[model samples]
Target: MSDAKLQSVLSSLSQVARQLEAVPSGRPAPDASCVKLNTNENPFPLPTIIMQSAIAALERQYLYPEDDNISLREAAANAYGVSNDQVIAGNGSSELLGLIYRAFLAPGDSVAMMSPGFSFNRKLAMSQGAQFLEIGWGEAHSLPIEQLLSGPAKDAKFILLANPNNPTGTFVPVADIERLLAQSDRLIVLDEAYVDFAPDNGLRLIDHYSNLLVLRTFSKSYAAAGVRVGFGFGHPEIIGRLRNIQNVFNMNVIGHAVGISVLAHRAAYAENHKHIKHERQRVTLALLQLGFSVIPSHANFLLAHVPAEQDGSWWQAALERQKILVAFFPDKGLQNHIRISIGTKEQMDAFLAAARDISGSLKMPSARRWAASGSASALRGR
Candidate 1:
């Protein structure tokens, strides 16, 4: 098409859509041999019963999945101790987050989230022509209740808080969350994607606060990232509105079957959860010993400040050279930090070995030159 025709066609798009450029196709996925510790995924296999359920579901490939995910929602309701009407199932909690943005945010409205939180919300808000406000966490990464209540966030359509927050892996106390819920009239969307790895959760607050919506996913803790099962629990009215706008047959048969089966046998993954926590601690200590400052993590990942000699990207690139993949954030205040998802013992061991090798190579040249110049001898004599 001519530029004139393309311009005319583009003019027909909404202002928001017109303002947003088409996303570029990114690079191909990493090599299979690379140790992937970038995205926080549970590197474990599904229990035998759950695998059997997924195989059974494949046999029904010709049939449509349950409408509105009724059976799966019922299973989640029973498992989480909520009424069926108060639940809404989605392909993933990410889908539910999109629904919340659609249902609550109009053009020119605003939403607030705890800063250094999930960065995806900014894109979601922009797609709706809504303002995205980022509120910083208080000292020690605690909830800044007064700031959230009295700051510009006071007028936001809703507040988004991720317990055991992403990128930082810092968890806020449930009592502090309850305090905020009690004072705020705005809808509070609590993303608990990593809660199973944390000590406490805010699910109980849903009963008392009509404004609280808790989101959970089977992707992280349940080792079903490929299956894409997630849920939202809130007041029946809120859930109903989200469900009304959700896509028809949003999830497939395998997702539905695996979701129900997992809920029924959640206890089966106790060892999986325990192993991640163990690895998280082990990695944290190892990073500290290597001259990286690691924040105490409650989630299945750790955020570490790289050594003073190099930035996070440098470390990330060096690790990639060793075929170990980890996450690096370029956002302000995060440029010096890298996040690593806790994987199995073998993966963590490989990552640690790579990190140590990188650290050693960095120090070797300086040590060699200084020693050759007799600087070390002079310092020792002094």
Candidate 2:
């Protein structure tokens, strides 16, 4: 097309669409040999029975998945002790989050979330041209109930709280959440993606509070990230609205089968959950001994402040050189912190060794810039 035609096509885009730049191509997947602790992925295999169910789903490849994911929803309902109408199944909880944003928000509306929570919600709010309010955690990462109830968040269409919040992994008590729900009429989205690792959960609150909506995923504790199974449980009215707007066949046959099978065999993952918790504790202690301050966590990951001599970016680059990959955030107040997912014993050991090496070598007068190609500095264009 000519330049004029291209310009005409672009001019037709909405203001919100135009404001957001297209995503640039990203680097290739990390080398398999690298110890990946960046994303909080439970690097374990499914139970034998669960794998068989997934394989069995192949026989239905020609047919579309169950409409509205009925069977899967039923399985989740049964597993979680809720009615079918109270549950909404999705490709992942992220999909349900998008549906909620669309169902409730319009241009100029506002939404709120616990600060340093999931970053994806910010993009979701932006796409809808809604104001995204980030309320900070109270003392000791507690829930700032009064602030959320009376402050700017009081007027938002909805509020999002992640138990054992992402990037921090600090859990707020269920009582605090219940108190918030009791005092506020606004819809509360409780993301329990890491709740299986936490001490308590707020699912029971849904029985009493119509405003409560709790989300769950099999990705973390159940080791099903690649399969994309997530659920939202709330009052039948709210769940029905989200279900009505959800796309047909959002999940594939394998996801449906695996979801149902996993629900039935949740007890089978007891040892896996135990292992992850063990590793989380072990790594936390190890990081503390290495002079890093790790926030107490109730999730499968740890967010630790890097040593005073170097920032998280420097540690990330140094660890990459050792073939150990962990997460680093450039968001405000997180510049010096790195998040590490708890992996197998061997992976944690390798990471600890690499961390020790980097910690010991921090004798330089200042944080040195890594100049190699694909270094964090290079990748971040610093």
TM-score of each prediction: 0.95, 0.95
lDDT of 1 by residue, 1-382 (tens): 9999999999998998888878789979679999999999999989999999999999998999999899999999999999999999999889999999999999999999999989989899999999899999999999999999999999999999999899899999899999999999999999999999999999988999999999999999999999999999999999999999999999999999999999999999999999999999999999999999999999999999998857888788778878999999888889999999999999999999999877776666666645543434312211
Q: Give the runs in model 1 whose Cα sits over 4 Å from its true position.
A: 366-382
Query: Model 2, range 1-382, lDDT digits (tens) per residue?
Result: 9999988988899887777777889869769999999989998899999999999999998999999999999999999898999999988889999999999999899999999999999999999989999999999999999999999999999999999899999999899999999999999999999999999999998989999999999888888999999999999999999999999999999999999999999999899889999999999999999889999999999999987756888778878989999999899989999999999999999999998876754543333523323344533422
- Lowest lDDT 10-residue stretch of candidate 1: 373-382
Query: With candidate 1 superimposed using the best TM-score fit, by how many Å does residue 257's alpha carbon deviate from the native?
Result: 0.5
Model 2 residue 46 distance off true place after TM-score fit, in angstroms: 0.5
lDDT of each: 0.92, 0.91
Location of the lowest summed lDDT over 10 successive residues in candidate 2: 365-374
Candidate 1, 267: how far from true, in Å? 0.8
Total clashing pairs in model 1: 0
Clashing pairs in 1: none
